[model samples]
Target: MAIPNEALRKVLMEIEQKSIQSSQQIQLVKAQIAAKKRESRILQLTASEVGVLPSGTAVYEGVGKMFIQTPPSDVMLRLEKEGSDLKNDVTNLEKKLHYLETTYTNSRNSFEQILTRAGGSV
Candidate 1:
């Protein structure tokens, strides 16, 4: 038996809401990935600039509002580790964004199909 139009319309509305939520989540993840990419680039540039310094040169790293003298090698190592962590974060966020996008597409398709089956347009 064919489902009632009212029921189908309700389901369609719910799916539409879900699709919108998924789209928002995808946007948030994309923003996070972009921010991480920028941070990683900054770290890389800082490391490159540090590479040109003499071995005896003092390096200072900012901690909160204070800057403490740090070894150049230590600074380089820390920057490398931070960059790696940021890269990993971006990768994970990308995967999450992909999942959200797929979910959103599926929800949208289902919403369209339901609307069509109900002989309606929104």
Candidate 2:
């Protein structure tokens, strides 16, 4: 099937927006992970003050109880893999966004020139 340049341009714009959004999401994930790390540190330090969190309970001092997660040895490995994947995706998306911006800029410039030739055709 054939596609018009305008349609293709719109599609590219959409792709660029999505990539920018994905990059933002990646940043958010990194922030949340940092927050989780801080929370974990707090839990470890306050564990004694909060007193053993009692495996069966969910709340103490207006906060949820903390339970240890016993994941398979590969959990960290998988998380590292996912982090690597996300970083790569963010990088690729940034590159694509740059290309899309350049393409859109060039296309608009070309169209503006065309209009100029037509004497205020725009």
Per-candidate clashes, comma-separated: 0, 0
lDDT of 1: 0.89
Model 1 residue 108 distance off true place after TM-score fit, in angstroms:
0.8
On TM-score, the candidate that comes out on top is 1
Model 2 lDDT tens row, 26-75:
56655655665565555445544334444445432322566444333333
- Note the Cα lDDT for every prediction shown: 0.89, 0.52
Q: What are the candidates' C-alpha RMSDs?
A: 1.4, 10.5
lDDT tens readout by residue for model 1, 1-122: 57876777788779989999998998889889889999998998999999999999999988999999998999999998998899889889988998999999999899878777767744
Error of 2 at 96 (Å): 0.9
Query: In candidate 2, residue 81 scores what lDDT?
Result: 57
